[model samples]
Target: MTLNVANCQRCGKVYLKNMYGMCGNCIKEIDLQYDKCLKYLREFRSCSITELSEATGVSHQLITKFIREGRISIKGNPNMTYDCEVCGTAIRENTMCEPCRSKLAKETNQMHEDENRKKLREAQENHNTFKIQDRLKDRF
Candidate 1:
């Protein structure tokens, strides 16, 4: 394991970087909030993210992070839904919905293909230029 020195993202305090980007104090506080959220969800299993945030005094952003990390799941609940990061489609888990994921995958593959084609074209042009220069030198 490598130890890295970095400033805590949450509190801006200098500390050793761990798996979590936050400092120890912030991590502890987040853990406490997680516990509270878990306890609340146990009682009200179908609450939306906003409702949970309001009830537990935790921020919606934090709750969304917890959900994305698989620490919390609100599956099969019609009232609870999160927007996909790419297309704003409602999703039950992860950052993107299935359609968006597929679309993004296709787009990424196309981008790679385009970049490869561009490099190939440039290489061919450079080779042609070199060949022309060699022919001119022979004539001289």
Candidate 2:
């Protein structure tokens, strides 16, 4: 009897079992959309997140995240200009993996809280100043 082996469509690698119709390596490769990126890369040679997004029909933020993870190959020189894959936040350089995603969420929440606190502080100060002005006006 002949053993049946599944092959990945993207990479043509043989796999014992199909994982969503693709082998593990091919899945990883396809996840980056490298082929789609290559077409744009060939046309532009170099592109920022926005430019690639418009050219490839992929979101700018997503492209940026892929670049940051080193998923998208550079034709000439390498540069860090990716976004947070999970949240679409622009990051200088880093993978938008689980840990980084968690950290970003925490920081974003903290920023919102800080902004709220600042608004409260400003309102309180304004109230106090108005009360003092009223008292001074009554005395004068």
Candidate 3:
């Protein structure tokens, strides 16, 4: 039987394909980094995201991913505020700030409304064109 395999996204080494898509070595390294970050957080309790990254030797992006994935939580630590993904504003929870999120929501709704209007107009135009048979001409 053939086996599933893929190159690790991090180190580019061939590995058995898994859900995470990373090789075992890279996964272990990330796990270690996570442990270090958790330990530091437990001890410090109030470090910013930059500080956590510096202490744990992990990238800010990975830490943000961990927070987004619910692996890291900032609820108890007020100093762990990170920048909003959409804007540079500092945010307490989630990636995007409230304003950015609301703006995106509004834009999405407007797009959907426009699409619906276009569809309705197209349907009306199609329905307006009808084939009328000339019964008198047919008889002639």
Candidate 4:
């Protein structure tokens, strides 16, 4: 695999880019925060993400990232909800709500169909051009 040198998004330090965008130091700090948040949640199982963030001094954004990564689970908690990434609808799990997902699926299918039609038209045009060239060659 190729490694690219990039400035860390968190600390602005130069480092070899891997799976994460942050430098080693920032990654270590985030790991520490994750551990702290996990411990706090284990002790206070009923706490919401915002409450856990306040109690542990971690950001709610990081807690949401943890939830999305499946590092933390907010199961059985109706109060713990996240907005869909595509739509503003409240969702219990995943990035997108069901309606948004269905809409995107239909759009994707339509796009594929349009692309296939374009390719077919190009192929037919090429075939007609080849046929014309063959007819000209026979006359010569």
The candidate maximizing lDDT is: 3
**In candidate 2, how many Å is residue 87 off?**
9.2
Model 2, residue pairs in steric clash? 64-82, 64-83, 65-83
Clash count, one per candidate = 0, 3, 0, 0
Stretches of model 3 off by over 4 angstroms after superposition? 129-140
Tens digit of per-residue lDDT, candidate 4, span 17-97: 868999999999999999998898777777776788889999877888988998878894446766788876778798999
Which stretches of model 2 miss by more than 4 angstroms?
1-33, 61-65, 74-80, 84-89, 96-140
After superposition, which runs of candidate 4 have C-alpha atoms over 4 Å from their true positions?
1-5, 16-19, 76-78, 120-140
The superposed Cα distance between candidate 1 and the true structure at residue 5, in angstroms, equals 4.7
Instruction: Pull out the clashing pairs in model 4.
Output: none
Q: Taking the tens digit of each residue's C-alpha lDDT, what string does model 3 give over 1-140?
A: 98899999999999999999999999999998888888999999889999999888899988887888888889988898778988889888877999999999999999999999999999988885534565556766
Best by TM-score: 3
Each candidate: what lDDT? 0.86, 0.68, 0.89, 0.85
Give me the displacement of residue 74 in model 2, in angstroms: 5.1
The clash tally of candidate 2 reads 3
lDDT of 1 at 13: 96
Candidate 1: tens digits of C-alpha lDDT, residues 1-140 = 96588999999998888889888999999999999989988888878878988999999888888888888777744567777988887778778999988889999999999999999999988874456678889998
TM-score of 3: 0.85
Q: After superposition, how far is residue 131 of candidate 4 from its true place, in Å?
A: 7.0
